[model samples]
Target: MPSDVRRTTLLTVAVLVWTLAGCRTVNRGLTEAVLDGEHARQWHIRYGSQSFYSLGDEGLAKIEFEGLIDRERVRVRYQRGMQGQAECVADVTTRLIEQVELRVGMTITTSTTIDLLRFDEPPQNFDIQLTVEPNEFPLPLFVRAGDESCTSILAQNRSYPYVLMHELVETSLAARAGGRVLPDVGYGWFGLGGSVNNYTRWFRDGLANYAGYLACEILSDEMDCPECPTRVAPLLHTSPLSRLATVRTRLFSWSQSSPSEHEREHYNAALGLFLLIEDRFGQQTIRDILADVATRETVDGRDLRAIASQVIGTDVKQFVADFEFPMIGGVLTPVTRALAANKGLNVAEGLLLEFVEPDGPADRAGLRPDDVIVAAASAPVADTIDFELALLRAGRPASIPLAIWRKDAGTIDVEFPLLYPGKD
Candidate 1:
């Protein structure tokens, strides 16, 4: 009887250990599948800001647009009879790049090759997959494949043109800002000094979406090209700034837990900042910001902010603050450093009203154009950013008291009502 009991106990213990191990194995597989696959590659392209200049090794060129462009120009070689649906979007991408070339101040002036290709008959009951023919010659573009046209696959995926937009913009801007072919200067210590180029990821990804939307809107109205496909159109509406505000988490710093988490922070925050730049300055200013960013490989987060501040003529943090809280229903421009010195404000921290919408919350609350915001909620506002932070600290109240400085009337206290609900 004692021997029987011991055998039973051993069996039970063995079963429990095996069950636990099985659970762990399943979980480990799931984690690897999710993190180490296509999702992982997406992070690499955007956050890693993959360099097209150096593709000496096959490892780096295994990406979506890998080896798509040869050393020289925008040339895509497809199989014969490949002109069906694939060439449509390919044409659109080419024309869009041409327009971007004009906008970013590069004329291209080189011949572009777009060949539509389709392979011969495959085995019966077999589907022929389209792929890119590798460029051994000086051809401009090559798509990877095994007896298939990759462009056809892209057109069917519905993310074809919009995804192509950003890549083209990035490539075009980099080519023009630096040169058609940029040389690789390795970063010191595991490429650490330059790999975490927060600015590159921020600008590359944000401007991609920012400019992509505008480009799509234009093409929709004018060219009837496939800009945003039906399925993916909704994804483009995500406002980077408002999303973070809703979550109540400010941008993540470099010391955060995971690289992916930090990368997510960079994407939304950068887009928010770019939207504000477009609002305060203009579209031209955003282009100019990109022009500066494309040339520098090591411009980190702070460097980007400073460069944007110089171009937009305001402290970049103000933009950060602008999206950090609810909308104040008016556009605010930072008081220039010289003007702030004349006004005795710290770092020239003050906001000048650029435009107040008629009958909007600002207009209704007696905020006028050219009126400077000196303080909010009885707290001194060092700048537009400070004003937003003050609003956030006060819980984004419906109505907050503000001290306004008008040129002729001097300082006046007013209850500024924030009626505009933040981005949806």
Candidate 2:
């Protein structure tokens, strides 16, 4: 065949193969191959490259990248197709290190690599999963994507920055302490074996949330006008003290509540406690606690309490006791009973409003603290459980009649609209 004819024939065959690949799963593999190479090379140059291999156990291949921040080489790795995201994460992380160091006035000598993963679809059972390699020198930090569609932009903005800062702070503490800092017990009762002994999930979570709040403040200020209000959102719907007061009963045992409740009540309670500590003792107290923990060879609930007491120059027991029981007489009791009795309100068969989130549907409907909820959607509201069930049964954004009894005012009826916070 002539040279031109031969060239034309080869081009036709290539186009046919490309067209066929476009219509099948094979196209994904081809595209991923191209992306993988491009991303690996880019990260390898931008952040120092370590190795390229399949994350054998994880069933994913990853490229490792490293960069220097304050004499520490921060490493980051990501699976294919998330190179840009990883780069953004790395940049944010570098800034976090500086912020943490400035706030704590401690150098983070420990080395760590942040691993990023993206999912095509949300996992059926899990949201995001973050793990830290406690024993490794250059600690391996794993960050996996959650259901992005389900997460609000506000939440993402708040949480992602917080997670980065929280991990860095924890890792920094671990580096100084010479090992992994055990999880917090939060509000676990004293005697439960596995239940009480397990690390307090809320402590770290609250700490992370606080860190996220701080990061938001920093970023917002950095990006905003000089006189603009702080960009960080409130950590909880109500005041920390109120949150702690309301959830006192549920704190004793993790098994008593669902995961969602744990996230809301316990985590917020923990954040509230930290906020209280910050309010009473100033920011240096937090630094002191972290520094003290770093020096300690081992840490436990008692150790943490002792550190808090030492730093604050007050009995940590009083704080715990206060959180567990906020009554004036030092009696440990549920907020419902305490409020009904103290306020001289009849509460034989009604859910007392311990809190009414500002601007929430309940608040918008004129609900207030100490108000007794008699009925919702014509159903008797005997307790919180009943109220919750009624709300669920009422479904989303339903305007239903609510019967409330006020001490000064007579029995009042109002239409309450049930709504989700971030949904509407």
Leading candidate by TM-score: 2
Give the alpha carbon lDDT tens digit for every residue of 1-424 in model 1. 6999999996687577668788677567656876777543333444532222222235223333312322244455444333333444355556665675545433333334443323232211222222332221111222224434443344333343454555455444334343332222336685456433243444545566555555554455445433224222234433354544543224423222235645654655555555556665666887786567656664555666677788888776565555454566677766765766665544344687889978777787798887888899989764443565466556556788999887668889998875545433
Which candidate number has the best lDDT? Answer: 2
Q: Candidate 1: worst 10 consecutive residues by lDDT?
A: 134-143
On a 0 to 100 scale, what is the lDDT of residue 378 in model 1?
A: 85
- Per-model tally of clashing residue pairs: 14, 5
Model 1 regions more than 4 Å off: 1-73, 84-87, 101-155, 171-200, 222-237, 244-258, 290-303, 324-424
Q: What's the residue-level lDDT of 16 in candidate 1?
A: 77
**Model 2 regions lying over 4 Å from their true place:** 1-59, 62-73, 77-88, 104-132, 135-159, 171-177, 184-205, 223-241, 248-263, 320-424
lDDT of each: 0.52, 0.53
